[model samples]
Target chain A: MARAGLNAERLTRAGADLADELGFDQVTLSALASRFEVRVASLYSHVRGSADLRARIALFALAELADRAADALAGRSGKDALAALANVYRDYARTHPGRYAATQLRLDPETAAASAGPRHAQLTRAILRGYDLTGTDQTHAVRLLGSVFHGYVSLELGGGFDHSAPDTEETWSRILDALDSLLRNWPD
Target chain B: MARAGLNAERLTRAGADLADELGFDQVTLSALASRFEVRVASLYSHVRGSADLRARIALFALAELADRAADALAGRSGKDALAALANVYRDYARTHPGRYAATQLRLDPETAAASAGPRHAQLTRAILRGYDLTGTDQTHAVRLLGSVFHGYVSLELGGGFDHSAPDTEETWSRILDALDSLLRNWPD
Candidate 1:
């Protein structure tokens, strides 16, 4: 009965919720089917397999995150733009920890190429365009931004900032100031 | 029988190597025991269980990485220090992919407190001191350094940098230059 009502979109949303509850790694087809109280073969009509389910989750997370980034970056420029962009990720990771984890799953090259990952790069480049970086340097700056943003967020999510020092949020704000300044004065 | 010759150290090293080959998640005690041509019971004598084996691999990777950082940072300061520190991690990941993956495993707070991970933070702080920051800003700087270094290396290792543009090496150099500049002239 439930199989007739199930669709890829609904299954993927269910999978994302399951990811939030039991950590991302535990979201498998069998487990998902059991959650839906549907037989495995019945569930197969909606999801191709576990990998397909995961890819859908990843796509969902990416689109949601990209939308959030677009909102934060709107009407913001310079250091303000940088801070807002960085905050979007940190906030998302804190709020939807499961969906955030799904964003980091290994996608095949084609899936990755087609995902909202490009939107992410485009947004970063848009911010950088306001700065004075050139060709190869611009490319390098994009990579640096990607690395720092991904790195800090992942670590913070992993509790790398639970120390008795200044909280990571404060640190994150300062790093953005530093990054904005770094972009403004990229070296020769 | 081989539990007779095996101990925690050997098991940890073997686990790290196995991680390098099959990946961190794939490095199970049963798989490792088979590799050693021994029984699973023998491995238990050296390592308490699965979690213990993983913790040991994480410890081994952290220490090896820290030692490599020390060697690279010796007689180096400022930009040179940053480059040396950055290369050590990237190189380690390239050479021992599995061990690097194990290093990302979430350790228990107590185990993490007892890990060389602190020494890693200290070394990073020391490198920042070679720049000009102090107090809480130093902590921020340290977090930034950790984020960029770990983020870039992990992304590159995971093929996040295999774009149709310039190679990751060139991007890495420019990133180092950019970071050095950022550190040298951290914004107020």
Candidate 2:
């Protein structure tokens, strides 16, 4: 019998909330079972197990993040678009750290292709369209941008910049400025 | 009484090796006890528990990485120093994935001050001396470089660049080139 209030979608949202609270690593099936006041076996009907639950959360977070990126990209280009996209990630990570971490989960090839991963790449490409890069140069710039954003956000969230001077915000803007300068004058 | 042939250093080394085999999360006091063929209680004599063991591993990894970075940076400047420092992290992470992950563990303020973390920052600053950055600009550059290197290595390690076109090596060199170009022409 299907539970009136419990389904994969509902469970995923709850699990995501739990992840934000306890962290992505702590959002286990047993923990969710406890939260829902349901048996672990019952959850198996809605989702396969722990891995499946995490995968669902990952997919959910990816879609949500991609949507935000798309919204941020509308009618923006160059450094404006870059800052918009970058801030979306930094803001999402700060506000929903667990969900942010979940987006980093490595999905299998088939699942990854079906997820918002491609949209993320496309959105990044859109920002690059403002630059003069093309072909492999564009791909390289995409990877570089991905690295800086991911690295900076992960470090900031992990307290890597908590003790540093000059403030993270200053560094963030300067880094963006530097990226804009680099993109405009990309070397051979 | 201390156990013969067993000490904190030895246990930490064994734990780091086990982390490489099973991942950092899987390295626990009980697991180390099993590896040592002793009881967990006996293991506690050497280290407080799981947290202490992990902290020690983090410090050890940080020191090892700093040492390698310092060595790679010898007799190099400008882009050479940058690439050398970047390559040390990438090679160390590829060879010692577990230990590399350990270096990222968030340490308490006091512990962080005492760890090789400061040296890692100093080494980064040393690279910045090759450019025109100073004061906050230098700090911003430091944070930016840290983010790119950390972000790129992490994504690569997590297979983010796998299944993508142009191969990671090409992207890596191009990123270094772009970074070199950016540092040379940082915006005002």
Question: Which candidate number has the best TM-score?
Answer: 2
Every model's DockQ, to 2 decimals? Answer: 0.88, 0.87
Candidate 1 local lDDT, B120-147, one digit each (tens): 9989987986798978889999999999
> Which residue window of length 10 is worst by lDDT in model 2 chain B?
B1-10
Please report, in order, the local distance difference test score of every candidate based on alpha carbons: 0.86, 0.91
Q: Comparing only chain A of model 2 with the true chain A, what is the TM-score?
A: 0.96
Considering the two chains of model 1, state its CAPRI-style docking category. high
Top-scoring candidate (lDDT): 2
Model 2 interface DockQ? 0.87
Write model 2 residue lDDT over B1-188, tens digit each, in one string. 55557799999899889888888878988888888778889887889888999999999999989999999999999999999999999998888888988988889989988999889889999998899876788889888999999999988987788778999999999999999888888888
Q: For each candidate, give its TM-score against the true structure.
A: 0.94, 0.95
Q: What CAPRI grade goes to candidate 2?
A: high
TM-score of 1: 0.94
Most DockQ-accurate candidate: 1
